[model samples]
Target: MMFEYMDKMVMFQDTPEGLTADMGWLKEAGENGWELVSSVPLIAPNRDGIAYGTVGCQMILKRPKPTQ
Candidate 1:
């Protein structure tokens, strides 16, 4: 069996509206047959080289490879 993978980064402003948008993106991916495998928080660094907080998430998805 073969598989294909995709990595999607969804960003947000740490607000309710941002969360809604992110959820929409994930929903769209699911509708396209992409299965969620893992999710990792994405953090942004400050200008002083310090990790502030999570600004988004990195979603890893996989699906069966299509054969031609």
Candidate 2:
């Protein structure tokens, strides 16, 4: 069988300003037959030899490839 694939993701910041989530986008992707493969957080390291967490988020999505 043949298939097609697609990807979508959402992210935010860890600032004192604020953060936003594009749920509608994810919803639309799902409506388009996309599946959530993974949800990972973006991180960074400082000179303290320790890793710090930020408001960054990485979402991986994929859908079955379509046949011609």
Tens digits of per-residue lDDT, candidate 2, 1-68, equal: 54455545456744476776657787888898888877887676789968865556677777777665
Model 1 over residues 1-68: C-alpha lDDT tens digits?
79899998877664655553347777787888899999999888999989998888888999888987
RMSD, one per candidate, in order: 2.3, 3.1
Worst 10 residues of 1 by lDDT: 13-22
Residue 17 in model 2: lDDT: 68
Count of steric clashes across candidates, in order: 0, 4
Model 1 segments beyond 4 Å from truth? Answer: 16-21
Q: After superposition, how far is residue 19 of candidate 1 from its true place, in Å?
A: 5.7
Off by over 4 Å in 2: 1-9, 13-20, 46-49
